[model samples]
Each structure stands twice: as structure tokens, then as C-alpha cells.
Target: MSNVIIIGSGAGGGAAAWRLTSKGLKVQILEAGPSFDPLTDYKQDNSDWETPFPVKEGSQGGYIVAPLQPLTEETQDIRSWSFMNGKYVPGAFRTSFGYHHVRGFGGSSLHFTGEAHRLNPKSMSLQSDYGVGADWPFKYEDLEYYWRIAEKISGVCGPSTEQRSPKNDRVLGTPHPISYASQALAAGARKLGLTVTENSLAVNSTPQDDRADCNYCGGCLRGCQRGDKGSIDVTYLRRAMQTGNLTVTSSTEVLKIITNANRITGVLAAVDGVLKVIEADLVILSAGSIFSPQILLNSESVHSPEGLCNDSDQVGKNLMETLLATSTALHPDKLGSHRGLPVDWISWDFNDPISIPNVIGGCRFSPSMAESDVVGPIAYATRIVDGWGKDHKRNMQEAFGRILSISGIGESLPNSKTFVDLASETNSHGLPLPRINSYIDEMATDRLRFMMTTCRNILAAAGCAAPIEEFSSIDAFSSTHIFGTCRMGNVTEECVVNSYGQSFRWPNLYIADASVFPSSGGGESPGLTVQALAIRSADHILRNKGVQ
Candidate 1:
């Protein structure tokens, strides 16, 4: 029997394994996708330039996304925002959803842009501060220590304390210089009296832990070929293996969790291709917000008619996704916006709810060019140019190295309209595919509108004649940071886990992923926090069961 069984090898699971194995606990990880070796698999140095990155979601990388719901079309609608007689107006933009996530040894971090962010201290108290989303059980100060630890291991590069980001003040490593496009955006933001701060990225700016620094290749989303980008595979999982107490099983899809009375006994999974039950003393669900709850819901038995660890029937409730809006403009100069890091600069001037008067939550925008893949001439032809042949070629040439994009990340308040559940159909693995339904409430829409307008203003401030606004309040199914399916709170009936990510319903069964986040903090990337929570959960386990 394994000492501990973690059902994923992503950010949360990797960190949990690192801490537990370092402390002398035998750990096993079952992942649904194959792992990759950066040296051979990345191939960024030799890849053909014609190939577009971020291959269709779930189509490649063994990551399957749930079918889009409620609203299915990808076309821009009026409900979000549109030009009415050359004036921007809100139209009937229905929210079509597409989850962009990679399921592999390192999970979504394999393709993530590596922006390691922490929640704004005030954002941790959404219920107390803004009355929109629920408040976290603990304060930012409680998690700061863990954030620092995650950053150190991940080799995060950022501004110093004196030049700290609004979200985290204790950043360690130094950040790279802003891209030319970002420099323009910064100048524009400063003109508007907004402070554009350096981004805290989980990329090595200097050699650390034997990994090379970033070469500014601008292929972050395609998976970093160089060991510089701090994906969990190279950071936490590598450390866990160094302890020699961790075993990672790839291409093992979970079927259901087996429980004996009030505690988890093991997990039934398809190991490679064979179905088997792996026994364990403890089980940690790190399969992300979607699959984690789906596993619980599929674990229904005579004892748990609904599901294990789901007495509150909140297994798949309160599914919150990333709320986003962005704009792009054509610059006069070939700023070479694609060479450096994707989003080197961000602004938090309007990151406070109080700063926006009636706005209940906050939002942030960044100068995103390379990270968005708005760089290559091919990208210009496909994304910016509308025609074909000669005209298109000329337009592409005109737009190359001249595109500037500003994107906003905002908090999506948990609403009854948005959630996930079991669908009637099954996936290729025969498990019932999770059904996700998402909505954008008026309050959330207000935030999206603010972000849209703000991005456009920044572009204009940067001396661009026209900044095309793209409002995704009801479109652009960017589930970049999913959360709150199995929420954590104080009340047992109202929560799925405790402050330390221990499940309330089942003993020795814990969740250390985005599934346990009570609320989606304001525009913060969830990776670092996921690691911190998992580490904390492992420590809680150590406190109860003894490490050795």
C-alpha cells in the first residue's frame, strides 16, 4: 500500500509531493497524460515558423476540455460590447466557454505563461471588503510565507520589496526589462497617473538551482524548451524525485475514488492501459477544479448516494473561471514587441474596488504581446489582417512588429448560473464527462467593461491612433485560472475542505488545488497559491500522522 496517493502531478500535487517526500513520506502520483523531457520534446529551437502555437484546446496534449455550454458560438456578440454607429455599445454577447488547459505530468503549468501572482490582501476578503464573493478563511499574511517558499523553488523573477507588486510585497528575484510594446504601454499608463509595475513571473531571470535563465524566446505558452521557465515539472516534481520517495505514473486516468466508511482507501484508475485499484493510507485530490469534483461525484455508493466528501452537494458548485477583456492596436514603429517576455508590465491603479466607486471587485490589465502570440508575421496575417493574397501580405508586413495588446484579468464572482456537473455522455475513458455552465452577472460585466475601456485608453495614451477593443465578458472562454468547485470554508455544510485543505466529509482525504479556493481572488494567477495550499495541506498531514 502506498503511504500517500496524489491523483495529479500538476502545480498542487507536485508541491505536495515535494514537501511530503522531502519529509520522508512515500508518495505516488497518477497522471492522465504523458510527461515530456524539455531537451527533446520542446523542440522550440528547431520548430518550423509556420506552425501556430497553443494548438486547439483538448485536441492536443491529451488535455480534454468540456464542450462549450450555454453559449456556444465564438463570434463576437452585442451583449458584451460592439460598435453601434461607430460608438461602442453593449450588445447581446452570450458567453461561450472553452477551457484551455493541458493535462500532463506537470498539468496546465506545462503551457502556462508562468505569471506567478498572489492574491491582493484585500482580495482575500471579498465578502468582507466588497460583499461579492466569499472570503478566504485565512489572511494574506498567513499564506505569504508559503508564497515565498514556492517562489524560491520555482525561481520566480520579480521586482524587489521597494518596487513590489501591489499583490505581493516580498518578491525575491529580479525581473527582465520590459518589452518595447510594454515600454509604450507604461508611458501611456504613467501619463494617466497609473503606475505600471513589473510582473512577477515564474521564469528564471538568473541561473538558479542549475537551471538556465530565460533567453527571451517568447514561446512561453507553447511550453518553454529551455529549463528557464519554471514549470512545476522542473521545480517541485524534480525536487520530489531527488528525495527518492515519489513515483509518478503517467497516462493513468482516474475512474473513481474508493472509500471505506469515512476515509478514503484507494483510487481506481487505468494505469497506462490496465484498470487497477491502488491502495493508499491517504488520498489527495489535485486533479483540478473540474476533474476533482467529477471524481467525487462519480464516487457515489450506498454510503454516499450523492458522492464521497460531498454531503453538502457542493462537489461541483460555484465554478469560477477567469474573467477577461483586451484590446489591440497598430503602432507606427516596428517596436519588435515579440522578442522579450510576454507581459513584462502590469497596472493595478484600478485594482482596488474602492477606487472604482460602485465597482464591487477589482481588475488589472497588462501589456501582453508575445504571451498572447500577437508577434509573428503569421500571427499578424491570421489575427490582424482581414484579407488574403497580395493585400493581406502587404497588411501583414505593415502590422508586423507593430502590434500592441493590453489584456485585463478580473475577478469573477461566484453565481448560481455558473457551475459544473456530470453530463449524460461519457468521455473516451468512459467516465461521465463534466458539464460546465458559465455566466457573467451584471456586477462581473461591469468589471469587464471597466477593463475593456481601460485597456483602450492605455493604448490611446501610448500614442496609438486606434486601439481595437475586444470585450470577452460573455465570450472568450479563457478558463485560465479555474476555482471554487469544492469550496473551503469554516462551516461544514457550506464548504468542501478546511483552511488547510483537509476535506470535511472524509478522513485522510484532502484537496490541495483550485477546487478548494473559496472565492476567485481579484485577477491574481492561481498557480503560486495552489502550491502554497498544497504545501500547507501536506504539513497538516505531517502534524496529524507523523512524517517518518
Candidate 2:
């Protein structure tokens, strides 16, 4: 039997494979999508590229990938996403809406903005802070060392002051100077009694670990052609391959987990529609939030008829996504903003309720590098810009240097209703398709509105002529940051994975993906948190022989 078989070669699996193989263990990684050569597959000019239809287009049969944003339902290669209200609705047959990510070697992190911030201590104690959501089995301190490890491995360079733990005391490289726009926004926010800090991002600011610094090109959403971004393919996966103990099988879809007497034994996969099975002593499911749970739900055996390691019925519950929206403001004078950092200034006060009662959210205001093709022209033409060619150019010329673009990211509390399960409809291979039943509670929506209003006020305070807020509909949920389809908890009955990320029902099975996040780490970007937890879980598995 193989020593380890890791599903998905994303952040979690890539980190695990790096750590495990470095410890002199054999590891095989299975990815459901084709291998993407960054230079070959990515096109910087999106205008020439084939993009998926807009969500308002009401069609489901196309797929597209943006380097920064997570994949939406409109980007699906096939109309296969199932939305769950009562019965599952197929993607092509009906307009089943969802914010599900796609299959890839690096997973959703491939398209994520390189902002990497650790979770606040309060996030680890959700039950204690809000009287809602379960607390994490482990504390931030438990993963502090691993956080640093992941940081060094990924070559993340940011302000050392942003790190909450002492173990993260050492600064890896020179901090990127805060942009002029960020400095000005911070000044304005301070007037409102809100403190804005330089954001902790994962992009390399200086040369470290053989990786180059960011060119400040600001095309992060289209994939980094510069090689400065610290994605898994550049970091862990690269190191894992160096060890020669890790084998990566791209374009291989995992169909089921082969188990015997409640113990994981092997994995069944389909590579280009050819069946392949490999026996393993240990299995780590790091297929991501939605896909991870879908895998568990699809894997059925004599011992687990419902799904593998799903005796608790909590495999696909407590779904949560961070609330997000953009706000636009017209500045009095040209700030020359969009030339610097991606997300430079952020409000820590808005992430929690210490500042605002009964409301948990976070707000960040910055100059938006508006997309010229998709959102910007559409937004300008639909509302503000009245005329077509020359008049539109004149209006865009006026707006281009004067626009102050802002964005707000909020958290959604754990609610079982916002979950993903298998739809009744099956895929082309006769497997049940994934279904999303996600909906934000009133608290989350209210918090979103509050953040948007706060953004408008902040812009106004910053000397904007006028600021407008854009509201999102309930149907649009997938701006990346989806969590809790396979949560961790104190008890076997309430959660799918234990504190150590081991399956309660299956002894040799484990999960290292974002799906195991207990309460979604509500505030800040969760890239560091995911890496820290994966490193710690990997260390635990290696030491304790796979149990907590």
C-alpha cells in the first residue's frame, strides 16, 4: 500500500505533500483537472481570451478562470452546478445558481488575491465571543509555529506588526511601502475613529527563497505572469517535487475512497475516463470546501451507504462565505491611486462587534483597478456614462483618474442551511452532482449594508464628490472564501473531522482543506490560516500516527 494518497494538489495538499515527503514518506497527489502551465495557459489580455457568460446571462454551459477571483457558476465548463432549495436543479437544465469553485491543480488559490492574514484570536473562540458557532478545538497559539513555516515556505513578505503571535516575529523581507492612496485613506478613516493598517499580503515584496518580488503590475486577477506570486506550484509543490518522494497525477478525478471495516484503504480515480485504483495506508482529502464534501457524499460502501466517513450527517453543514461587495466614490482631485498595491489599507475595527453592536463585519476602502472589459464599461454604461463612443471616452477620461474604488468584506455566521449536498441528478459518469443550499442570514445582509454605508461615509470623509454602493443579490455567493462543508468540532457526533483533522468514522482518513474550518475564520483573508492549519495537521498526523 502507498504511504499517503492526497486528493487535490492545492494549498492544503501541496503543503501536506511537501511536509510529508520532506519527512521521507511516499506521497501521491491526485488532481481532478488538467495541469496548467502558468505561461502557456494564462493570457494577460483578457479581451482576447474566451470568458464565461455573465451571471445575468442565465446560461450554464461554459467555463473561465480569472487569476484573482474565485470561479463562479457562470464559469463552469458544463451546466452541472445543482442549487438546493427542495430538490436539486441541474446546471444546464435549470438555472441553479451558486458560487462554487472549479477543479485545478492549485485549486481556488490559483485565482486568489495574494492577501494572507492570520485569523484573530476571537475567531478561534467563536462560541465564547458571540454565543453562536462552535469554538475551534485548537487555538491560534497551536498553529503559530506552523504559520511561520508556511509563511517562509510561501515566501510571504508583509509587516511583522500584523502577525498576532510572537513566533512570527522575524521579518522575512523588506516590507512593501504602503501606497499613497492607502496612506490617504488611513488618514481619513482615523477621523472616523477607525484605524486602518497596512494589509498582510502573501505576495513577495522582496526577493526571498529564490522567488522574485512583485512588479506592481496589478494584473493579479489574471494570474501572475511575473512569477512573484507565492502560489503552491511555486512553493510547496515545487519543494515536494525536489524531494523526489512526491508524485503528482494531474487531470485525475477521485471518484471514491476505498475503505474496509471503517478504515480507509485506497482511492478510486478516473484519468481521462480510464479507471484507476491505488491502495494506501493513509488518505488526506484536500479537495477544497465544496468539492471535499461532495467527494465524501459520493463515496459509498457497504459500511458507509450514505457516504464515506459521514456517520455524523454533519459532513456538509454550517456553510459560510465571507460577505463581500464593492463601493465606488468620485474623488475631488486625482489621487493617482490605482498605480500601487492591491489592497493596501484595511479596517480592523469593522471585522468584529466591539465597534458596532450585534454586527460582525470588516470594511476596506481603496482605489479599485476597475476592469476595462467586463465590469467597468458595463457599470459606466449602464448607469453613469450616457453616450456611446467619443462621449463615453470623455466621461471615462474624467472618471479614470478621479475614481476612488472601495470594497467591503464581511463574515457570515455558521448556519446549517448554507450547505452543499449531492443533487438527485447524476453527472455524465453516473455520480451525483454537487448541490448548494447556501443563503446568508439577515444579520449578514444587514452587516453588508452597514459596511457599504460605512464605505460611502469613509469616501465622503476622504473628500469625494459622491460615493455609491453596489448591492449584491442572494443568488451571487461565490466570491471565493467558501467554508464549512466538512467542519471540525469537539465531538464526533457534531462534526465530520476531529480537531486534528482526522475523520471520526474512518481511522485512516483525514481532511486538510478549507472545508474543515470550524467557524470560517470570519475576519480577514484566510490564506495564512489555511496554510497554518494544514501544516499543523500534517505535523500532528506525522507524530501521532494519524489520530489526535
Measured by lDDT, the strongest candidate is 1
lDDT per residue for candidate 1 within 372-415, as digits (tens), equals 56777666766667768898778777777887888888877789
The segments of candidate 1 whose C-alpha lies over 4 angstroms from its true place after superposition are 47-97, 162-171, 388-391, 468-471
lDDT of 2 by residue, 258-287 (tens): 888858889888876788888899999998
State each candidate's clash count. Answer: 5, 7
Clashes of 2: 7
In angstroms, give how far residue 350 of model 2 lies from its true place: 2.3
How high is each candidate's TM-score? 0.92, 0.86
Best by TM-score: 1
Q: How does residue 224 of candidate 2 score in lDDT?
A: 66
